[model samples]
Target: MIRTVLVALPLIVFAIAGLLAPLLSPYDPTSGDLAAGLQPPSVDHLLGTDQLGRDQLSRLLHGAQISLAVTAAVLALSLTVGVVAGAVAGYLGGRIDRVISRVIDMAISLPGMLVALAVIGVRGPGVVNLVIAMSLWAWSPYARIARAKVAGMRDSPHLDALRLLGAGPVRVIGKHLLPPALGPCLVYASTDVGAIVLGVATLSFLGLGVPPPFAEWGQMLIEGRPFLASTWWLAYPPGIAITAVVFASNLLGERLAGGDERPSILRWILPARRDRTVCAKDDVVLRVQDLSVGYPRRVVADVSYEVRRGEVLAVVGESGSGKSTSVLAPFGLLDPTAVVTGSIGHTKRVGVVFQDNLAVFNPLRTIGSHVDEAVRNAGRRPVRRVSEELLALVGLPAVARSYPHELSGGMRQRVQIAIALAGEPELLIADEPTSALDVTVQAQLLDLLARLRDELSMAMIVVSHDLAVVSRLADNVAVMYAGRIVESGPLLTVINSPAHPYTRGLLDAVPRPGAAPGTRFRTMPGRGGAGPDDSAGCAFAPRCPIAVPACGQGRPVLDVVTAGHRSACPEEGV
Candidate 1:
């Protein structure tokens, strides 16, 4: 933003001077006083009189009107044509993108100066012809940039979600596609302005543009060329002015475009700012009250829970029970299709351990580099030191230089934990943290998590289908079924004496040693998936063993059972 202002300052001054050219200058730009020809700087003529005895400052100010106007017109024309073409091509791929891209390549290959000269030669030298010729090829760069940007972003999650919401192509492109594409295009147009202006002057210099004693910078230069040795004042002023404008514009545009070729040490030198935590005033790490995640249909609804510092809230449910969706909703990490509702509060930032280590970890980056990136993003300098410490903390002291593929499943999970810890986030969300690990490794990782929670004083929300894991690690438990939490409370109470039938069903399904050898384990009847989107009654009524006709009358909510315990239905208990 600073760069943009600085570059625009010179143009602002030129505009004011141009508008007041007659008032500011003591002499007419065209009607030169030949009697005082070949004069250098004096009290009367600020920049001296030209060979035509015209005030140099006056001609320069007047020339700015023509130059600035032509550049502005060119930018408007180029961007309009380029952006429209590129957007259509990018968003609607196949023949359209290929055909337009081919045309762009051909157009770019044409020699711009030669094409302009040829056009001027055919139509004769004039401003209209000059503008037409220059504008012919000016849009190519913007077209290519817009096309690439839109094509890359066309399949992004948000755009896909917008489509699923029944948004038309025009609305989607205008709202989602154009914004990202506009940035690079604007930067190109800004920096290209000075060049386009300079091109106009060059055309005039070659007798292909504004000709005569009409007070143009190029025409003035032409008149002063013979006196180069005799007087430097004649040509140097216009030359310096042109150079300054282009330099300032390029400097500003490059920065605004964020064209940094590589990372800078300055990022490390700058002190990091601490963002205010969003946790409750009473030391609650995270809280989600009446939260619901909406897809095209509502997936999870009216779920509420809180996690105090160092406490783990395990969200347990079977497949398609919205365990992942419910846990992720609090962090605002659900898919874009999910319209999350209700309140979520956290005192500090969050970090996560993803379900698939390979999908989340960059294939090209080593464990150390991955940890370094996380640390750097968190504003910690010298990532090497922090990464080393975090690796030791996660019990992988020797695996810093190892790649994701090089480590075992457990070691990779530790790397994920280390990366999460790098941010020093107050709340950590681990989605099915033990799913891919062997039983022994899962036990080790859960134990590691317990120790880390104690050491870091951070709260966690772990999503899983395993009851044994929850009983061991979770302080609080929320059992979900049919896109809703059936029961929630202290883990011990919920585990030992669950009050909701759905919660009881989940616990009963797990195989027990007391059962006879070779006896089959219990399983819930019905699909046990998310309920119909428009259903008015309890979604789990169909599968509930104790469900009566009244259970289908209305949606049930979490009602208080015992102290510090809640159940969605009052009918069942362990």
Candidate 2:
């Protein structure tokens, strides 16, 4: 409430003063009485008299008229020139962009205030000259902003579709580019409004403003300057007015821009992964070797693992350790730009249960609708019958008519499993399946998956960050770091005795009730790996507590420590 009052109060006061100037004050501002010279603000005048004994209140009120007029005119003119120039330059690149950009560079190079001074000095300082001088360089920033906006939208699929549908330059700019760009462009323009007012006031105070007796705030300041000792009222009010208006516009501009700094959805979509195809020599349900995902930067690399019939292998890691990248390849969901090396071998049907069930299930469709569609798409049984059977199998028969949003998180996930099962897959990949559920619900889901795995004799690959989930259900574990699997072995063997430094660090970082009362919780000292950019060395070397000189020399390949157990490090300890 206080903020609203602060922002609105000045606006209301100035607007009314400018609009109702004539009626608000009875005295004629220009024709002051010599007999009442230097009157200390009484019934006749509210603020006090200036050096000329003019009614200060009346003059201040009228001064707003020029201030507002110049501000509005300058804004309109600058925006027109800037937005148009910037849009043309950015949208149509090549020679046109270069030429316009150079011109903008030149315009900004000549200081605006200096140019204004020269123009006003020659034109003999007045409202018209002041407006023209201030406007000369104002439009350049707006144009540059607009052009950048247009360039960003150039490769947008929707815009390309519009062009393919025969959109002209006018249609594209007016309908598509300008509207979205306007939000930020106007934000830039609004910030300049405050500066423009200050600039005008500054020029006026220095004697280049509208001539005396015109009732301008800057001229008022000059008139009040000599009375600094006894009368502070002379200089203070105009200064306060200028400060208020400029400060208010800055706050208003920030509000107008609607600041939201989240990443765009387009950033999520990259080039689909290209596979290198590593053919497995042994007979297995799924085999992937030498897999790396991306260009410019790789998220996951040197990945090699296999899943046998009825085997449950869990790929575990921290959030960005490439857990999702490792599992997503079998479903063919990796970005097109991602460079996926190593072949993924799977002969039978593959069923996938995604992490976010709310996003996976259509809000408009009922639980049964999805099941029915999946069953029908497979061409096996009647939609109603097969869907009902699948639903019953996953313990969601009562939710057949319920929409996805109507069900709880766990229930929605169960429905997703039922849909996946409709394909009768030999291999099922559940990515972060139990991460979003409560303890009770998670246990139930895990038991359900275990039951399903046993009943169907299915091979499963589960991807998760929660070591608890991995420990409970996985037959074997693949510990991932910086996109590569640093360790793999039987679940009990990996948990009871982790082989890699990263695997040990991950286990140590988890909080436990078994610690001493004053024991501080543990954390990995550095980032787990070489990050997305460093491609030459062992990713975990920087954070590895036992790291030696040889660790950073080159990438380490996985070596067998025991019969089925493996570790990527070449250290002495097995």
TM-score of each: 0.52, 0.51
lDDT of 1 by residue, 1-574 (tens): 5645766777667767767887887778887888988788999888988887888878888887777677777788888778878887899999999999998787677888788888889999777787887877888888888998899988989888999999998998787788788888997887887788788878887777887867666766777788999988888887776776677666566555443222332222111211122233247877788877776677777778888876899999888888888777766677767787899887667889989877888775578878876876776544566667778878898987788899988888888998887776778889998987898999999999998766556688999988777777899998888778889899999988888887888888787867888897778798876643335687777888888899888778788989989988867543
Candidate lDDT values, in order: 0.78, 0.78
What is candidate 2's lDDT per residue for 165-247, written digit by digit as tens? 99998898887887776667787776687798888889888999778778888888887888877787777888888888887
Off by over 4 Å in 2: 1-6, 106-110, 154-181, 259-338, 341-574
Best by TM-score: 1
Consecutive 10-residue window with the lowest summed lDDT within model 2: 268-277
Q: Native-vs-model 1 lDDT?
A: 0.78
**Which residue pairs collide, candidate 1?**
277-347, 278-346, 278-347, 279-346, 279-347, 294-339
- Decoy 1 TM-score against native: 0.52
lDDT of 1 at 49: 85
How much is the lDDT of residue 558 in candidate 1? 82
Per-model C-alpha RMSD: 14.7, 18.6
Against the true structure, candidate 2 reaches a TM-score of 0.51
